[model samples]
Target chain A: MEIFIALLKGLLPVAYLICLWFYGQLFFSADETKQSRWAKLSVAIAVCMHTALLFSLAAQYHRCPLWTQGEALLFLAWMLAIVHLLSEWSADTRRLGFFTLGPAAFCATVALSFLGKELMLDAQYRSSWFIFHIVASLAAYAAFSLAAVLAALYLTLHRKLKLKTFDLTFRKLPPLDKLDKLSAMWSFLGTLLMLASTVIGVWWVRRDGLHGMSPREIGIFVVLAIFLFTAAARRTLGWRGRRHAIWILAGFAALVLANLAGLHGFHF
Target chain B: MILNAPSQPQVFVLGANHLTASVSLRDRLLLDEKSIQEFAETLLKDGVVKELSILSTCNRSEIYGMAEDPKAARTHIENAWAARRNVSEDEIRTHGYFLSETEAIRHLFRVMGSLDSMVLGEMQILGQVKDSYQLASQNGWTDFYLNHIFQSGFHTGKRIHSETTIHEGAVSISYAAVELARKVLGDLRGRVVGVVGAGEMGELAAQHLHKAGARSFLFFNRSMGPAERMAAAFGGESRLLSELQEHMGQCDIVISATGAPDIVITREHVQGALRHRHGRPLFLVDIAAPRDIDPLVGEIENTFLFTIDDLKNAVSGNLELRRQEAHKAEAIVEEEAARIESWSRALGVVPVLRTLREKYQAITDREIEKWAAGQPPELRTHLESLGRGLLNKFLHAPTTRLKQLGEQGDGSRASYYADLLFALAREEKQHGD
Candidate 1:
């Protein structure tokens, strides 16, 4: 079982890399639509492999795959892949996979690099509510990451349109308004999930009678506030286009920092 | 049973296109629906062609047919076409080509795939070809040969479109404008389109935008008369050019082609409009000579400004891309034409196969009679069945090989070799004697 788990952990990044390569070929090739079937098959295979690996880790560790930053990152990569597949399915835009899956594969590789050194699961990982908190928080992060990728694409396309550089990349991107709307949708979902996870964290801490909040907890609040403000400004203040995309990207950066600064300090 | 001789009908096309004839000549050669029907009926009645279909468009006039004598048929078609159009035969012969067999099939494939079109990668030719085929089939002017060829042509065209990026982008200026609008604003439905010139260019731009599903139109001209007329035509409101800035915020796409000598829409004007736009991006197309919108307006955030030169550049770039994709389409056409030719060759050996089978059966029957005569009734019947089964088993591999050779474009030689190797004709002659 240990060997099997180790093999799966090793293969997870390879699967994602294959998925990313297929998607990249589909996006950058002249016969763009012809590669959709292969892209879909690779994505399905990689996602399934990632899912099995996560489940195997959970079963072996006797807890959710959220015990450490590395495991959490693997879980986050899985969520990102799932979200990407869902987004591609909903929007019928498979070209976005190149952008979405690149970061997903990178995260998987980085997570794998932390294999032998970070196998020691924390002893403090106990209550079911902690699983919920970590899962929701990571899922929120995945959504924000997707939003940032889309925001970056939006900015690129925005500049391309302004510069009148009607090249292959310009042709491959989705319409600007559609990208904007999709980015906003992901941002809103991330804000809601972040808010829910924060609420769940406070409830868990109170029920357990934890004394004080960590700086990381305070950082999460700040990131959550930034997303909340982004959503509100987009809705009420009519902040859209460049302002909207830049704001989402900034919020995602803050969230990344908050997570990195507190990589090993998430204890209830 | 005696089989009729193979007809050996050849597929052929005689036509003139933009490359071969001037516009006036092509226009003169145009045949209306009724005239095309008359010409098809006459040719069919005269037995000049076995099957016929005529494709007449503004840029090309083509006659696709199958006949026993392509040279005579070509002459007949040219003469008839000239007489119908009241043109001289010399004029028709000078401008048109008479291609037969594989060349004809290749030409038809190219036509259906839009590689032969005046505007490369345009999709209208596919529909025109379909309409012509449908018309010919409905009038009983087409048979299996013509039907298969046209169907293959359609399939090839569809494959070329889906497999290559030939017809992926807009080619014309007005359509390119609408494409830019779509790229920037997503769906054009319910988007307000502001037309600033009310001239031919503006009308053309508006027409393309409407075709792209933009229903709301705002027409502005230096004078209110033309603007109102244009607005009424598109079922939208009209305004004077002087009041353009006041209502510019209402439009999502603004196409300015006014005849003003200097810059009519300044950076400040767009700045004022963007303030009221609430972060919505505005796409402005200045198609006027000397430009209507300020160049500095393009530098503003959330405002995408394009001039006539930009759109022209896009059009040229798309044309170049189409030219590259046309190479892929031509390769597909060549492949499909070769396939059809191979299939046609295979078809030519059908009679030979039937004759060979009949001769082998006769030989088997004679042998069964000669050997089984002395056996008991049951034994003789068993011998008969065994002899026939042996003959069939012996023939299976050779028959498959013969058909394979035929499809590989050696049907005539294969047929000759089958006759000599099996002594089929000699056996038949000896039986007759």
Candidate 2:
């Protein structure tokens, strides 16, 4: 059982890397004016690879699959990329695969790096409420990651257009209005998930009353607060264009910093 | 068959276009019936030409001719144009391009197909060139070879345009005007359009406007007759030249294509129309050569005035797209031309192959007759049959090779084999005598 779990963990990163490379080649070499059949096929393969990795991790751990810090982050990144990839694929925006798949590959590599030892099975985390809290937090982080990608693309394209340097890359990007609307859409969904995750975390804290205050919970709460504030500003203050782009980038940066410090930094 | 026949007749084209000459110069050089007759008569009388035809359009004037002596014919045609148009010989000679033989044939095909037009791939030149050919034919000005070449040129031109997307989009000023109007107005249904002049350009613009679903059209011209005729033909109303301003105020779009020397519509006239329409957008299309509308009228709010230059800018982008399409069209033309050439060359080889086959079979028949002469009466027939079978086997390889060569357009082999077969038949006849 241990050997099969180790093999599965190792195969997950390899599969992710293959998916990333295939998607990059498919999108980067595609003709901008016409649909690419090869790109679609590559994306379909990548989706299957991601699904296989997700299933292997879930089956091997025999729990909610977020027991370890690396597993939690990796699961979150995989969920983010898969959700975005499926949505964009259905929308026929195959170009988004390059942005979303790259981060998923990075997270998968990080998860693979922690693959040698079995995760510490915490009896405390076996509770249904705790599992729900972890899942909601990770799912929220995944949604924010997708929003950050669209925000980054919007800023890049807006800068290029302002500089009056039209190029093939710019031409291949979605229109500024479309990118803005897409970013706002993801940000709205991410904000809602973050709020739900925060509520669950608070509820778990109130119900257990055994765990002491820690930097990880504080970091997650601060990140969630920032995302909620930015989403409100985007809607109420009518914050858009370059200003919205900056806020999105700042919120994503904060989340990354919190995740790294709370989860990956202590382990390494 | 004659060996080493002289090469076929050569062709030459000399012409000037809008780029090389002004509209005035082009119009002056344009040959009418009397002029073409006089020119043809002069050439024949002076013994300076073999065969010739003239093609003239708003953009170009060209003379296509065949000559036994190209140098003398070139000099004679240049001098003749100089005298006719009252220009210096050097001036006429410098602007005109002289293409001989294959180049001339290629130029004729290009010109008839509108590849050489100022607006590349415009369809008007094909009809114009066809008209010129018909006129030349009626005048008894062209011989058999010239007629065949012109007819083939027309056919090639039609094939190139139809089989490819070279003439798919708007390339001319009139077409660009219509395209811009459609873009600005979104849709032309229930729109009233006013045509300021009843000239050729105005007629074309009105036709496009009508096709775009403009409900009512009003025509105004310096002369009432042509305007009324155009309006009646299109199921529209005609307004008097004096009511131009009133019509301009009422119509949703105004297409001005006049030959007026000065600006016909001033800024004040447009401002007055804008007020009467209560801020509704008005599209003004000025397709006149010298520009009929005042250039300043474009500045008025709620009114969009597009002169020829503005239309040209829009057309310039589309011209790049047309150029790309033209490359595809050229590929199609090259393929078709090769197919035609191969077919014509194959026709040339068929007769020689037939003659060679007939001579070989005759020799085989004679040999069978001689072999069967001394056999027993009943056995003779069987012996002749055996001889015929042997002859069929002997001829199979050469016959297969000849047929393959004919299919592949190797006329050289056909001539060589024909000569050998003829020699064999002659030698056999001599030995028997």
Candidate 3:
């Protein structure tokens, strides 16, 4: 069983490579939007392999595989893959897979490197409150990451329009208004999840009287504040275009910082 | 089965354009709406062609049809067009080029792509082509062959434009005016366009703007008659030029193209219009030679003023870009035309396949019935199965080979199959003899 888990973990990268090959075909084909079967199939297969790997890890740990912060990374990657499939199904856009799945594959690979460490399962992790807090926080991170990618694309299209440079790539991207709306939708959802997670964390702290605020807590508050400010700007300042995209990028930076800084048990 | 001769292509097109004929001659040969219907009926009655459509524009006049005798049909159209325009046969011969079969299909595709227009990448040709097609359709002049050809032409035209950057910029001055309005206000579906002046340029600009999806229109001229005429033409309301300022406040775009020697639209009136506009952007296109609108109106906030010179400069800049894009369009046209030609060539194999199937089925049915006569029910079933299997076995080689020949562009293979079908039936009959 151990060897099988290891082999499956190793196959994730191979699956990503196959997906990349199919993605290149979809991106480069002149007129085959309705014929991207290989890309879809490879993504579905990669997602299945990742799911099996997660289940195997859960079996070994005797818990939901997300007991430690490192395990949360794998859950986040799974959310990324699932979100990408959902976006494709909803938007009918194949171009987004490379952006979404490329980061997902990278995160999964990083999670695999952390497999030799202890699972860190304890009584506190078994509590439903801690589980919801961690899972919701990671899911929000996934949403913000998707928003950041869309914001970056919006800025690229904005730059191209300002420069008056038209090309096939420019033509293939979603319309500017649609991109702005999608990015805003994702940011709004992310902000709601982040607020919910923060509320849960505060309740936990009050109930247990744990360690005081740390750098990771500050990072989370700052990220949450940035997104709330962006939401306010949309109505008050009529914020859109370059300014809106920049706000999402800034929030994404804070999200990355929080993930890196949250370690010493003083963090959410 | 009566199979069509393989070498005589059915579809043909004959036309003279700005490239082939003088503008005066093209103008004389132009067919109006009623004349188009008349000519369609006349050509169908001539018996030389079974299908007909006349695409008459200021730049060109062309006839598209399906003909029994492609060459004779070409001459018949040439003679008819000459008689209608009161020109001589020698004149039509000198000016017109007759296109048959693949050339006709290729030429239609090129025309649809605007590669054959006077100005490269002009979009009006597409609308004119569609109108001609619709006219032909309504008159019942379009048969299956013409229908397929026109539909394919429309699809190929759309594919070329979308896949290539051929139609990147506006090529005409009037359309350039509309494009300028659209650049500031994306999607002009709900926008109001006010045409101030009844000049030819103003009318043309309004027509193009309306086609681009501007819903509301206001026509203003010093004379009420001209204003009403313009209003009736564009499906809009007419307001006297004296009352232009009162109505200008409601318009999103104002086109100034009056024949007045002085400025017809002043800065003060435009600035006042901006006040009522509530910061919404206003586009002013002053396409008069003597300069109709005040250029100072451009300095006002939220107002874009473009004059005749600005439009001219825009046209020149876009013309260079269009020239470059037209190169890509040429390759696209060539590729798609070849694709359409290949389709028509494949059409040639249809009758051959039909004839082969019918002839073999008849031979198998007759032979099986004769052999099964006076036999028991079990023996008859077995004999019928044997005949069916033998027919399939016999046809497997030739039908596959014929389809392969069609794919390989072997025209004579169709004729060869034609002869072989007859010879095989005859040989089977002789064996029975």
iRMSD for each candidate structure, in the order shown: 1.4, 11.2, 5.9
lDDT per residue as tens, model 1, A10-111: 788888878888899899876665678889999999989898888888788776777777888888888999889889989876888999888889988898
Looking at chain B only, the TM-scores across the models are 0.89, 0.57, 0.68
Q: What's the chain B TM-score of candidate 2?
A: 0.57
- lDDT tens digits, residues A1-268, model 3? 8998889988987897788778766665443433377798899999999899889988986778887655878888888888778778876557766766777888887877776585566464457788788878888888898888888887776565444444445545665555666788888889999999999988876776566777888899999999999888865665765678899999999889987895636423
Give per-residue lDDT, candidate 3, residue B36.
81
lDDT of model 3 at residue B132? 90
Give per-residue CA lDDT, model 1, range B1-433, as digits (tens).
Answer: 2333388889999989999999999999899899999999988888879999999999999999999999999888888888899677888889878899999999999988989888899888999999999999999999999999999999999988888888878888999999999999999999999999878999999999999999999998888899999898899999888898999998999999888899989999999998888888899999999889999999998899999989999999999999998999999998999899888989877877888888888778888899888788998889888988898899899889988998997887888888788776676677779
Q: How are the candidates ranked when ordered by lDDT, highest leading?
A: 1, 3, 2
Where model 3 places Cα greater than 4 Å from the true spot, the runs are: A1-63, A68-71, A81-123, A157-182, A237-241, B1-7, B32-34, B44-46, B50-53, B66-69, B118-155, B168-359, B374-386, B406-422, B425-433
Give the CA lDDT, 0 to 100, for residue A162 in model 3. 42
Candidate of highest TM-score: 1
After superposition, the stretches of candidate 1 with alpha carbons farther than 4 Å from their true spots are A1-11, A60-62, A113-117, A211-215, A264-268, B1-7, B357-396, B426-433
Q: What is the TM-score of chain A alone in each candidate?
A: 0.95, 0.86, 0.93
Residue lDDT tens for model 2, A1-268: 5666566566666666665665565455432222245556655665566566667767766765677766676677677667667657555556767787778778777766764355575465467887777777777777778778888987787665444333435545665656766777777777787778778767766676545656666676777777777777766665666677778888888887777665411210
Count backbone overlaps in model 3.
0
Worst 10 residues of 1 chain B by lDDT: B1-10
DockQ of each: 0.70, 0.02, 0.14
Task: Please give, as one word, the docking class of candidate 3.
Answer: incorrect
**lDDT of model 3, residue A232:** 84
